[model samples]
Structures are given as structure tokens and as C-alpha cells.
Target: MAYSLDDLLNPQVSKVTRSTDNLIITTYGARGQGKTPVATKMEKPFYFAFGKSGLSGINNVDFQPVNSWSDFKSLVKLFSNKKNYEQLHEKYHTLVLDEMEILYKYCEQYVASTEGVRKIKEGNGGYGLWGDLKDEWENEIMKIIGSGFCVMFILHACADDTGKIMPVGDLKRMLPIILNHSDIIGYVRGNGSDPETGKPIHSSLMLSDTDEYFARTRNEYFVPYIEDYTAENLVNAYYDALDRQEKAEGTSTVTKEEGDKMYEKQRITFDELMGKVAECIEKMCNAKRDEEVVDIVEKTLGKGGKVSQCTAKQYEAVEVILNDLEEALA
Candidate 1:
């Protein structure tokens, strides 16, 4: 076929937004951070449990225990079938790969076996073996993602000899591919049970990269960290952030300087808000009696009685109080 000048001259405008439901996400953190439990709460998740202990007590969510790379290939083949994929698409909204580090090991094992070698580096006379392994890994994974299933990868944090934590191992080599494909990479940490409900609470999800761990979110609306982490809460935050961005962009046509100013104005941070709350609490404690303190706390936080239990609106109201107190104290 000959190249067409007509086609060369015309280019379609690409979509500026993507569907939130189909995001490619990777969540990683220390063990017992509720990574698996929180992932199950994601939109109609279907899990591929690759680690031996990954599915011990999980309930209600559909899952398959993947043992070998060949088993994974069979799954790819099954999903390649049009009818089978349709059935899956109907039943599941997200396809989760639990314990991604183990999956990387499985890839290495498969590569080693296929080349009749004890180690992956022994394959192809030590030439292109790593590339081959990476190719196989990315190809198989992308096939499933291309089939329209939202993909979530879960990884456990590994600490280096120097005590730096990361999602490492054979996965370190595949980080580029994972990073390229994923829209969000969050590091989860902290563990506490809700005092009132007795349910497990994942304290926070860190979406910003730090010296200790790797994490990121491409969405500008997503905060650097999410407290009291859950998939539902995360999703709601994502959409709310998206809404704010969209509304900001829609407000007016302006120069870059004006737009940047507007963005900075809208960027009131969690740390800043919490700092204000702390200041207010300290002032009230110093200036009032015990009974007055109780009354003020009840008036501010209402029945929640704790900052963690407060909703977004309650936090906003608290922010208002903090501002008023600052002025009054000054």
C-alpha cells in the first residue's frame, strides 16, 4: 500500500480525559497494610492471587490462584477468546494481580525452563535473555489490559540492606514497564482498627515518591497522601479532585500566569489544614477550662469526636473555625 498525502495532512484531536473506571494502577507497601482487602473493595475486582498466602482469609471476591507462568499463559489464551472475554467483561470491572513480585519470579522460572537453564541469565548464551524475559512479561500482561479490563497490581514492600524500602526483586528490572503502564502507584502504610466499628483501617496511602519508597499519581487532583485509605474513599477523592480541576479549567480563558495563580490559590494542602486544626486545639486547651474544652470539641467535631472520623464537609467547617480563631487571636 502507498502512503496517502491526505492522511498525512489530517490528524484528529486526542481525548484529554480517560475513564476513571479503567485506570491502570499499582499499589505497593509494607505487609499487613490492608493492600489486598482494600483492592477487593475496588470496582468488581477479579483477583489473580500469585502468592501462597495472598488469599487465606479473603471473602466474597472472585479469585484464581496462579501457580506457574504456563498457568498465566493459559489464562491469557482463555481471555483471548472473544466469547470468554465478553463473559469476563460482564462479570468483572477490574483484574488484579496480587503480589506482583511473585509473578515476576514466575516469569523468571518460565524463562529459565524454556531455555533449559538454571538461571534466566544462562539463556540465549547470556545474550538478550533479560530482554526476552521482559518482552514475555510485558506482552502477556498487556494482552489482558488491552482486552479492556482495568488492571491493578499489588506488590509488597522490600527493604534493602541499608533499610530503604521499595518494590524490588526481579520486579526491579520490570519497574519501567510497570511505571509506564500504571497511572497511579501508591505506597500503603499504617494499621489501626476503627474504634467505633471495629473494622480494620488502612491508615494512609502515599501517592508521592519518597526517599524510602517509590510511588506516584499522574492525576493532578490526587493528593500526595490519602488518610484512612480505602478504595471507595480513594475513588471518591479522585473524582472530586478531577471535578475541581475541570471546574478550574472551565472558569475562564486566561494567560498562563493567571492560570497558575488560580491553581496555587486552589491548592490548600492536607498538612496545612491539619496544622490549622492543631493550632486551634492548642489555643482552646490553653485558654479554656476542661468543661469548656469538651463543649468546644463537641461543637467543632460533633459526634465524630476525632479528626479522622470527620467527613470532608466537617473538615471544611473546621478550616473555617481555624481561620476565624487565627484572626480573633491576632
Candidate 2:
């Protein structure tokens, strides 16, 4: 079967009528800012702690301590499998990955071990290597995403020399791709002991992006800031955002000029290009037939052009194919 321009223009992806319990969330904060405790509050969470010490005081959490990158890869393989994921989902509805920075190190270690390179730089054929790392990381993460389980990724926040708080080092290189997958990105602020009482003050989660750090929720309905942060509140805000979306769907319409203006307002950076390529690869990976993969390639880059060779100029075409495939799948 072939799709025509009419089909492409009006996709068959069903209207999203209800809220989903599962979400992809990322939260970062300074050490001892209660990032882990906040995650532990998520529904039936199963933790995969990359660091050694964080979980000592945290209780009632079922976790697998990851000793090496290989262990983490094994877990990914296990959970990404459909039957295995089904069984795991019965017991755990959420998966929490702690220490995002450490996980990046593990990814680098895995890449180094497999590629026999100590340094990752464009000079050292790092573009392909970095792409490989990104592909592997994104591929595994998407599988987990498609698994229909809530995911909470925890990262440590660091202040740059000029005092901008954000993810640093290798993890910084991958933040854009990770953020593309997240529905919510929050920065936790754990209030330290009060001067007079030596007890904790009110801490909060920042959901709006700031000049100082990376943070944002998907919609206006999501609480811009969460005070006395708990996983429940975050989840509720997610539902509210969904409810608003559901209510607003088809209630109003966008004129072509307005749609064009809205589209023009979107900033598609190079990192987003990388993200689209990742999505293309993900589609190829899950493609039911070799012909479907070939169709994607032909539709995006013309015959015999590899997706790995896609440039920024090819972004819109790539997105069109991806959207078509998504609608077809849906």
C-alpha cells in the first residue's frame, strides 16, 4: 500500500483522548537535595543506582546496584524485551535511573572498551563514536519508553564558573537528546537546615526554565513550580496538563497562517537534528518489515542515501517520514 499527499496531510494518528499514567521525567539538583527521595516517592519504582552510596539511607525501594556499564546494558536488554517487560511491569510501574553523570561515564567506558579508544573527540573519529553512543543510549531508552512505564532519571546539578547551574561534562553533550525524550525536566531545591532550628526549610521543584538552569514542563497546566515537592504532585500536574490538552483538542482550530507562524516559532537546532535521526533509527529498529525501513530511507533521503548521512537540510523531510510512520503505526 502506498500513501498519497492527502494521507500525508491528514494523518490517521488517533486523537489522544485520555491521560497516560506513564511519563518520562528528569530531575536534577545539587547533592543532598533529596533527588533520590523524590524519585522513591514515584509509583512502585524500581531503582537502578549507578553510584555506590546514595541509597544507603533511602528505604523501601527495590533496586539493582549497577557495578559496570555491562550490568546496565544487560538490564536494558532484559527490560526492552516485550515478554520480560510485561512481567516486570506487573511488579514495577516505574524505573528510576540515579546518577545521570555516572551513567554517562559508564556509556563512555562501554564505548571505549568496544571501540578501543581512550578519547572521544571529533579529531579521534568521535563524531561517529559519539553518534554510536547516542544511538545506543537513545535506542535503549526509547525501547523503555515504548514499554509504557513511568521513568524517572536523576542527575546531579553543578554550577559553572559563572554560576549557571546545569549538567556538566559528557552528560552535557547528551542533555538535548535526553530532554527531547522527557515530558518534564525539573530542578530540585532542597532547603538546608534553618539557622535557628537546625531543621530543614521548605524545598521545591522548579519546572520552568531559567537563565541559570535547565527546567521545564510540557504544558502551561503543569505547575510551573512545585513547593514541598512530592512525586504525587508532579504526577497530578502531569494529569492536569493532559486533561487540559484533552479538553482543548478540536475545541478551537488553527488557521494556516497561524499554523505557519507557530511552526516558524519552533527552533530546530543541530541537536534536534540528531534527535530526529535517532527517531529515524528507532523506527528502523522497530520496523516490521525491511520494506518499511527502505520506505523510510527513500522517503527521507531518496534512494540509497543513508540516514547516517542526513544533514540539517534534510530535517523537514525526515520529520515528515517519521510523522507518517507514527500515524501509520498508531
Candidate 3:
């Protein structure tokens, strides 16, 4: 079924559009659920876990297991900020959020505590909190999606009285947002061993959406370099996925030199890039200026290369060395 543009534009009329290429994989089960296994398979990824431990077991990844909701909020804000993450994002690929149930709790508490909402809640003596928090929750979600980063939201599957599966945070009306916004939604369930009798076990990954569009393999976009549960794998997968997108658009990955130039455009300085320049200078001097035997080679000189004479990168190296000198003296 289709409708005219004007008809579709009305707020009352509903439409679904996937504007972001992000994938939100929700992993759930009991406390020991292997939700982490799925994220570990990705390349160049980082984990911000609110629960679960053994982060050291995973390699090629950065892990931030938060002990409190405040830590989670602050980290999320930092990661999404363009100033902090831009350089890091250039070097990495995936961002995974383990135990999204924690963030779910934070969102509820956050919205309920906001000055505007708190006033309403206080006036109502706590009766209006649920209504007040809906917009705040949506705003938090918008920030996450618009962050332009690959995110994985992990949750636990809870069994209701009816023995039906529900996401851990489903009680707070989070399931719908988790469902509608997620590029992929799934669960992990395992067999419970009967204490009395020995029996075979069965486990499966449950898909949330019945739509045919989601049935296609997500691997088509991002192919793993190898079989491993490492952040490097997530990173590799992210690159491959993005490369596939570029290939479809008739483009290719840029060389390191080109990528450096692109990064320099944003005022980012690479230590390795500076090291490469020093190596190149040494190579050229060895071939031509070896006879001169200069006592020291300086990339930048305040005496000759004044404040305005150097490029931003040259200034960076000079500033770093100067900072070292100041620290040494102190």
C-alpha cells in the first residue's frame, strides 16, 4: 500500500525509513548468557559494559565496564562528542554497549530527575514520572543514533509469568524503541539441564522481526577477517562493511597517505606520521648531506621557524617536545 506525499507527511500517518546504517544487536538470556560472544566476533570494537566481567579475556578491544550509571552517562557523552571521538573514530571501527539494561535504568532515572520533569513529578507526588520521561528517553536515543558510530546494545531476556520472553528493560516501555530503531534484534536462549535426568541441550538465536527485509545476512555489509572475539575483528568488520557500501557507490578505500591528509584537515596530529617524516629526513640526509654531519636535526626551530613559518603539524611536534622540557624542569 502507498499514499501521496502530502498524505504521508502528516504526523498521524505512519511510515518507516531506515536513515542510519547502524546495527543494534540485542543479546539476551540468563546471567551467564553469551551475549558478549556475538560482539567479540566483530573487528576494531570497544566495549562499555554495565554488567558481566572477564573483560581481559577479550583481545583487540577497549573495555570500559562501568560501576555506576553516572559513569555510563559521562562515557556515552564523551564518546559521542565530535571533539573527543573524531580522532579515535578515524582509527577504530565498532562501539559496543554491553548490558543496555543499565542505560535503560539511567534514562528512566535521568528523565525523572530533570528539573522540568522533577517539578512535574514532585507536583504530582511521583505520579507523572512515566509520562514525563518519554521525551527524555527518545532524546537520549536520538543522540546515540546521530552519533555516527556503530553500536551494539546488549540486554538480558526475562521470562514473564506466562513464560514468554521479554527484554530485560521491557517493563519501562523500552522494548518498542529497541525494536523499531534496531537494525538487527535477536536473543540467545540455552537449554536448562534437568537435575534429575541427563538430556541433550538445544540453544538458538531468536530473531525479533518477522519482516523479510531483516532476514538477509548482516554479514553482507561487514565480513569478518577471521574467526575471533576481538575488537580488531569488529574493526575489520566495520571497514569491510563500509568498504562494501563504498564499492556499491563506485569508490574505494583511501591509502594511508591520503587518510593522513584527510585527518590533517581536521587538525589531528598522528605521532606515527611525525615519526615517518623524521625517518624520511634521515634517509634524505644520509644520501646527500652525510658529509655535513650536523650535530642535531631539528624538525622545528624557534630561531629560524617562527610562530607563523611552520605548518600546524610542525607546531604540534615542537609543542610536544617543549612540553616535555617544561615537565623535566619541574
Candidate 4:
């Protein structure tokens, strides 16, 4: 079928309906840190308990007990199915995977058994088996996450040889894969005395990464730490961040000339470029050294030139500076 010149030249504009919010949240912490209870507090939660330990104190949340990797796969399949997806979505707003580490162990065991090996690193084909297991686990979990349901994975924290806290796993490759897919990664902390009550605070969620533990949030509006970790609080924070982002985007528009220039240079929209530049400027200002800021701008974006006047190559250099500054500040 051939189209007319008008059809080819003119494009219809539609209202944007897609959201940039991170619906997949992963939380890791020590045992009895209230991870399960906090997760269960989400609206219309459907919890999948990989271990019975997390189920002791929680109540009133609909839950399913999954003992094996096969069970996990079956659940994923049910949710991924189009016919069943709508029903599940109506019944549950959030799907919680309690003790995701146990699920990963089950995946490891299943992989080993299927390959007729005693361990993941067994025989001459150990690396191949590990790769297969990693792929399988990532594929299955991602399927559930992409099924249009808000998903939360609850993991047990373990320290690596370098003492960096991460989800319990033998394969170091697994952590990055999971974190890459997650929108929010949080660490639950407790074992501190409350100053006011002088009582033990069972748990708090750290939403940003520090030198001691691995955690992060894509939402800039999200607080670095939440003293009370609850499903309601987490959901509220996420929506609030989304709202702020929407408002910011609404005010930031790219002009036709700017859009054309960006296109010519294979660059992003003016608004996005300016946002990055603004962030870099703010960080530089926070450093409180005029001479250092001047040197950085001159070295990256050129001497006496504003970011708005930067070429694509200069913008890339400025971005590199921004990344370095962010890491240094962090």
C-alpha cells in the first residue's frame, strides 16, 4: 500500500499517556526488619512468599507460598497471560516477592538438577551453566515485572568479600542484572535506638546508595531515607516524584529550531539537554569554588561560553564533567 505525500509529510500528534515512574521496587535487609510488613501495606497487595519466615507477623494480605522455581515460573506465566492478567490486575495492585534470594536459590537448584550437575560450578561446563541459570532467572522475573502490575522484590542482604551489601547470590552478575531492571533499590536498616522513645526501631528504608550499602531511586523527589518504611509511604513518594516530573516537563518545551538542531546533531530534546546542564551548574555552584567552576566550564564547554551555546561535542564533554562532579559529591 502506498501513501500520499500529505500522509508521509504530516504526522499526527497524540497526547502522551505513558508514565516514566518506576513500578518495580526491590528492598533488601536483614531478617525481622519488617520488609514483609512494609511491603504488605501497599494497596491491594498479592504477596508471593518464597520462605515462610517472612509470613510470621504479616496479616490480611493475600499471599501465595512458592516453594520452587517451577512454582515461581507458573505464577509468572499466569500473570503474563493476557486472559488472566486483567483479573489479577483488578484484584491486586502490587505483587510482592518476599525473600527473593530464596527464589534465586531455587533457580540455582533447578538449573543444577536439570543439567545433571551437583553444583552450578560443576564439571568443565560450569560457566555455561551459570550463564544459563542467570538468563533463566532474569527472563522469568522480567516477564512478571512487564505484566503491567506493580512488582516489589524483597531480598535478604549479604555482604560480599569487599563488604559491600548485596542480595545473597553466588553469581556477581545477578546483582547488576536485577538492579538494572529495578526502578527503585532500597536497603532496610534497623538495630538503632530511637532518641525520643529510647526504644528499638525495627527498620528503616534507605532509598539512596551510600558507601556502606547498595541502594538507589530514579525519582529525584524521593527522600534518601525513610524512617518508617510502609507500602503506603513508598507508593506516595513514587507518585509524588512522578507528579513533579510531569510538572517540570510541562513547563519545559523545545522550540522547533532547537529541535531541528538537536536532530541534526543526533542529540536529545532541548529540555533534556538544559535539565542536565542545570543539574551540572547546580552541583558546580554547590562546590563553592569559583575558580574551579570556571576552569571546569572552560575545559569542557569552552571558555566564556554558556551551556546553551555548546555544540553537541561540547555538550558531551559537559555531561562527562557532570558525571565526575556527581561522583565526587556523592
Best by TM-score: 2
lDDT of each residue in 293-313, candidate 3, tens digit only: 121223335333332344655
Clashes of 2: 0
Tens digit per residue, CA lDDT, model 1, 1-330: 112366468733323243454478888877788888888988888888786788778779898778999888888777656578668777888888888778888998998998899898788887647887888988887787655566888887888676767775564466667767787888888777889999877669888887787788877767888887888888887766667777766632334334334323243666667676677667766876445544555666675366545565565665655654554455
Q: What's the number of clashes in each of the models?
A: 0, 0, 11, 0
lDDT of 2 by residue, 215-274 (tens): 887666676788878878877777677677757664433333343343233446756756
Please give the lDDT score for candidate 4.
0.73
Q: Write the per-residue lDDT of candidate 4 for residues 1-330, one digit (tens) a residue.
A: 122367558844333222322278889888778788888887788889887887786668798889999988998899878689767777887888887778888998888889888788893465658777878888987788777677888888888788988776545655666677788899999867779999867677898887789889866767788777776677777767656766966734333344334324244654576676677667668777556656666766666866666665555565665555554455
Off by over 4 Å in 1: 1-9, 16-18, 80-84, 126-128, 160-164, 191-200, 251-330
Off by over 4 Å in 4: 1-22, 123-128, 191-199, 251-330
RMSD of each: 25.9, 11.8, 17.7, 17.2
Among residues 3 or more apart in sequence or in different chains, the pairs in candidate 4 whose N, CA or C atoms overlap within 3 Å are: none
Model 1, residue pairs in steric clash: none
lDDT of 4 at 120: 82
lDDT for every model?
Answer: 0.73, 0.72, 0.54, 0.73
Per-prediction TM-score to the true structure, in the order listed: 0.67, 0.68, 0.50, 0.66
Model 2 alpha-carbon miss at residue 237, Å: 2.0
